[model samples]
Target: MGRPPCCDKVGVKKGPWTPEEDIILVSYIQEHGPGNWRSVPTNTGLLRCSKSCRLRWTNYLRPGIKRGNFTPHEEGMIIHLQALLGNRWAAIASYLPQRTDNDIKNYWNTHLKKRMKKFQTALDSSLVSNSSSSSQLLSKSQNDMNSTSLRSCSTYASSTENISKLLEGWMKASPKATTLKKDQEKEKPSNENTNVVGTASSQFTQTKVEEGECGVISHEELENFFSFENLNSMAWEKSSTDSTPQGSLSSLNDRFGTMTEVKERSSNRPAYCFSDKWILDEESGQVEDLMDLSLDCCSAPIF
Candidate 1:
């Protein structure tokens, strides 16, 4: 057998610690900064085992612990970091200053894991909704383009004299026109009311097309159709018509844009967010997967 248990079943106490025990442990730690647990009970005149004394100091009596409920953003960071790092609780705790690994581990088991699962479910639903909306928009645009193309072809087929010339010119120009149209479609938003649609359209045209193409009525027409100024004016008109204050769409867009950028960067590189090697599997004793993804090691707590 493996040597014998340290604390045998005799007068040794366990369970909820008493006030007297708390006071003794706190007093001992305050006076001497917790080096060896084996000597703690003997030196401090406490009846409890050295293991109990050490546990009390590490979990509760330590200074600078911000106890109580965690904020939503902090919870979010913890969940994200945990997924990347695994169960390396001490490492995870280091990122959250003043939080103990034991506390974090308990929180994860009791609360955060469930909350993260719910959040992930909601996120999946949102992604599905967005994808469905995008498909609907693309279908609508395709139908409209097919109808327009049919009308154009019929009109060209009617003219006898320039029929051959028109067909040759159209065949040559269609590919370029199709490319421009695809670019415009990609740039345009399903929600024409948003500032992004206009701004994105203008930028897309300016950067993707040459000066000559930019001058084309199709490009100019698209720009005018998707202009942010026009959308803002429309929003103001609607608000004025309704006798309500025009809600600031610009502010919402600004905040959303920043969040989107940060999310993109985080997804591209997870190492930046982790404080230590996250545990992937406790049973298997596996570490967090670290690929080529660039992590921001500067923000991580030193081991």
Candidate 2:
């Protein structure tokens, strides 16, 4: 179906409103107020059509009609509201108390739409970059975890193997010593002087072996090994002392020293050396370990 005409054709002028028509329309509306657009032109003696007079008043001469360019904030609000409400310019205009739908619609078409497109593009780019960064961090974390697990397994296996070798050496040496003792006993009567010297030599050899296997690790040396724990305890003590002004510095130092000694005795020592027999030589494993180390170093604080 064809669209209906805006106004009746009989004895009504159309098109652009003149300056005189504007003054007449503005004056008439100001004096009598607005209602029936069809009778406004005739009652007010305006040569212009009723639709034209209404348009002039509503679009331009109406009270609270905001002129000039829209602000950035207003543009943002228009774009956002437009996204929610679509092309319902009249409804959108109602929210912006001082602006007309005609003004709003023009601004949206000429300026607001382009600004919104730019905003959307920037938002999409930021989201993509953030997503990529998050994925990289997650992958790095997983790699570090895997490396830690492998290192633990390797250390455990090496320790077990070293213990086993030590036990086997002890077992072999015990039987040989027992056989030598029995032989020495049989020969003791035939040469009493030789037996005395032989016994002393054997005792010295056994002492040397025991000393070699279990190195002389002093209490002071053990304490130094747990220096990190001592440092941590000292920090804690300092923090507590700061809170309590009455706390004695000497007492705090003594407590820290005592805790350090206790930690040294309790802490499990790392193996002196991982047996070469138990170390893996796989290139893939080495690469993974290097990657994990890089990630750890990056994440760790320098201090």
Candidate 3:
């Protein structure tokens, strides 16, 4: 007779596990550790079979478990490993520590298997066409040859195997070639740093000449230009000019005309009016809006 099951099938729940059951199982495992599945359902009072409990923990609830779409790098690894290992998903999962054997199997069956099959079909067709053309060329070569039997025994299957091998070799060698090139570039810069230093000095001299041409001002000159004395003199001159009746009228007109000029600047939309009077005046229209709201509130009777 076969060995008895770990847990009886009778009275065992078989659907998706509830959150409460998960929490209970996780708590029990945390306290007592994960092995000895025969006692887990008995201890935690979960209605699941031992197999289901173990699968849930290993596939989903286990710590450090990664659950999401696989990355491209991971997809490549899975395809390459699958080609090498065949249907031994457990062995493949050992290479991908984050992925479970079940997940890897499901993903391969659902996604990668179809893609690889389609690609294999295309590759076979192309190889067949290439082989037929090569056979024609070989036959022509044999006909041209005198008294010599020339045989071309290359098959489509052999050609496909050679191509796969060539791709594998290229994949292995590409990284090493890139690293060697990068090292050569890095060494060149370090060995010829004198040119870099010379270029930097030349750039600094060019900047100095540009500043001279642009009339660069000294710090003292800038300070004198914005001095308090200069400011007071300018203010006195402006005040004296505004003291005249015509100048006062012209200044007032200019102040009032600024809003219209701003409006005219943007013909498609109305420009907002902004002035010192609107900002600095204490009695603006804001008080009226507040008063209107307060009056309405006081006049209305609340039930």
State the lDDT of candidate 3 residue by residue for 160-188, as single tens digits: 33433443354345664356445434433
Tens digits of lDDT, candidate 2, 1-303: 687776666767777655566667655654465557888878888876777887777776654454654543344345433533346576456445456788788776655454334333433454566443433444543453344323322233343334334433543456644564575454332322233224322332233222331123344643443233332233234333322312223432233343244344434332221101011111114323433443354331101
Higher lDDT: candidate 1 or 3?
3
In order, what lDDT does every prediction score?
Answer: 0.42, 0.44, 0.45
Model 2's TM-score against the true structure? 0.39
Better of 1 and 2 by TM-score: 1
Ten-residue segment with the worst summed lDDT in candidate 2?
273-282
Cα lDDT of model 1 by residue, 74-110, tens digit: 3434544454334546645645655667877876665
Residue 74 displacement (Å), model 3: 1.1
TM-scores of the candidates are: 0.41, 0.39, 0.41
Query: How would you order the candidates by lDDT, starting with the best?
Result: 3, 2, 1
Choose 2 or 3, whichever is better by TM-score. 3
How does model 2 fare in lDDT? 0.44
In model 1, residue pairs whose N, Cα or C atoms come closer than 3 Å (at least 3 residues apart or on different chains), thus clashing, are: 85-278, 85-279, 86-278, 86-279, 87-279, 271-295, 272-295, 272-296
